[model samples]
Target: MKVGVVTFPGSLDDVDAARAARLAGHDAVSLWHGDHDLKGVDAVVLPGGFSYGDYLRCGAISRFAPVMSEVLTAAQGGMPVLGICNGFQILCESHLLPGALIRNDHRKFGCLDQRVRVENTSTPWTSSYAQGQELTIVLKNGEGAYVADEVTLDRLEGEGRVVVRYVGNPNGSLRDIAGVTNERGNVVGLMPHPEHAVEDLTGPGTDGIGFFTSLLESAATA
Candidate 1:
């Protein structure tokens, strides 16, 4: 699969994200924030970073990036799209996924290997993981708390759209939510840096490979 990782002006993890995709046996393509095309990639990854310098709000201005328009259209047509960290904020702002990410309750920036449980094994991003499996993924951010209304929260839980849950609620995300998927299961917004966990040599473990590999399997079937 050819996976595209979008790079905004302030994006810091686009390179790492591309490497993660290559590590998973996929061709990694670079997509620009101002570009209006996807460059024919099979999947898209909105890598973690303070896009547009996190001005106004995290991912606020990025939701209108020219490239995002292409992404939004592709995602709506059932293309696999994964948003990590700041990218998660962009997804929510773009209305491709529900809920919003706000400042952490601790009122401090944090960086750690977070433990999250795989809550939904059916999404394109989690099919490679076993149900209830726990993964240690790199998480770093100051505004990483996920928030949504009670009704939206209930629907996500009842519909099995909650993709992953933080083991310790480190960021005070409602219901300990770490990641979520759209109704059709093609779009996923995760507040952790899974791409940073793909290499055992550079990261905590190989637990994050499942995410990228899962895309291949899903695309093959789709």
Candidate 2:
């Protein structure tokens, strides 16, 4: 399967995401934020970065990009989509996922290796992992706190949409939510940078490779 990684104006991890996709045995396609075309890829990944300089909000400006318009459409049609860090924020802004990412409770940027546990392995992007699997991945952002109304949170929890949760609650995210998936389980948005952790040479370890692998397996079975 071919996976397209979008590069927004300030995207910092688009290349890394593409590399991870390729390493996971899939074709990696480079996608531009200004392009309305998806290049006919099997899946899409919205990588981390301070898109559009994070002017109004972390992902507010980038959510209006031409590519995101297509992304939103494709995601609704069951094309697998994964969002990391700022990409997660854009997913929320685009209404592809629920809740919003806010400033860290500490009022400062956070950069560290965060430990998160997989709460659901049924999502397309997490099918390769076992439930309750723990992973240490890179986490860097200022606005990483996930917030949602109590009712919505309850619905997500009740429906098993909460895909992952921080093991130690690094950013004060509500209920320690580190990640979530859409109703169809095809779209996943998370705060951790799994792409960065796919290589042991440069990253903390290879614990993050399962995300890409899971997508590949899902595409094969689709």
Model 2 agreement with the true structure over 14-109: per-residue lDDT tens digits: 999999999999999999999989999989999999899999988999989999999999999999999999999999999999999999999999
Steric collisions counted per model: 0, 0
What's the lDDT for all of these models? 0.94, 0.94
Candidate 1 clashing pairs, residues 3+ apart or interchain: none
Query: What's the distance in Å from true for residue 39, model 1?
Result: 0.9
The TM-score obtained by model 1 is 0.98
Candidate 2, pairs of clashing residues: none
Error of 1 at 160 (Å): 0.3
For each candidate, C-alpha RMSD in Å?
A: 0.7, 0.7
